[model samples]
Target: MLGRLNHVGVATPSIDDAVARYRDVLGATQIGEAFDLPAQGVRVCFVDTPNSQIELLEPLGPESPIAKFLEKNPLGGQHHVCFEVPDIHAAKAELEGKGVRILGEPRIGAHGTPVIFAHPRDMGGMLTEFMETPREGAH
Candidate 1:
């Protein structure tokens, strides 16, 4: 139902500082350019690792979900983990059949693929995102 672990989403107060931390501190050199997802109400950057990627998300407005997360954890932390799926709608139906609670309807994700989030409560306290595999060259 799921492919490789796509990325680990980390909420941050500043994407710039987060990128710097990954570069100067972790010696990461494959950080993707930060971009704003106004529709999602956040700015996002990707720090590519050998195995997977680290996604840095900074809320664009106080009403963003990330901002609400920051209210509980001022320092910000792991927001969610995303996995690639061949078909998002199929995967959603499969998960629903198994009684997993999806947070909302599928929508365009950061990677320009359809995605849906499974509720944390139903996912053993971990918010899980399933994103459809991108087309060739989409990355």
Candidate 2:
């Protein structure tokens, strides 16, 4: 089962611009440095919030998934919502039993936790990510 709302993923044409909006306009003070996840084909930066976080995702390359999303809506928009889970494998099995389509095998996510994505069609047109919560004291 899901534990908490982990983060909301936002596809953006530029992470810098997104960060500027969150900081200058929204008055957000806790923002993480941008980093590349080449394997995931995205450059991400996190805007920390009281309850959850916002993940700004920019295309890392022409073939990146975000690139296609940006092409559809040049301004970019919400991509997915991630939820925390105590055990990712258990969650995957439970969702699979319910006939949900899992995007792929659980893999190391941006948070350094095991994570998996569920197909949007199975989730009310919203792509969902399930991330195992990191153990206390672990970065």
Candidate 3:
């Protein structure tokens, strides 16, 4: 049911510093950065690698999901695993139809792509994100 691992979400207090560290230490290059869906309260920076991507997530507010996660988890580390789907909206709907609770509705994610989150409880306590490249000519 899961698609390709799109990127690994890493919660960080300083996205620029994190991006620099990754670049200087691992030779990863920053691909892009964006702040989207203010309702979700996160600013993200994406770094490209040969096999995968590193997503640096910065919480926009204390009530943001990342903030809550940081309060209960480690200071900074992997947050969620994202799966690249052909159709995120459809996939989210399907999961909901099967009684899966969605964390948020579809919206433009930090990567400038359409994305949605599925509640961890529905997936064995693992937070999941479904993402898809916007269709051609789509905004």
> What TM-score, computed on C-alpha atoms, does each candidate reach?
0.97, 0.97, 0.82
lDDT of 1 at 86: 96
lDDT of 1 by residue, 1-139 (tens): 6599999999999998889899999999999999999988999999999999999999999989999999998888999999999999999999999999998899999999999999999988999999999999998
Residue pairs clashing, model 3? none
62-117 per-residue lDDT for model 2 (tens digits): 99999999999899999999999999999999999999999989999899999999
Model 3, range 88-107, lDDT digits (tens) per residue? 87898888999999876798
Q: Indicate the residue-level lDDT of 98 in model 1.
A: 97
Ranking by TM-score: 2, 1, 3
> Candidate 2 regions off by >4 Å?
none
Scored by lDDT, model 1 comes in at 0.94
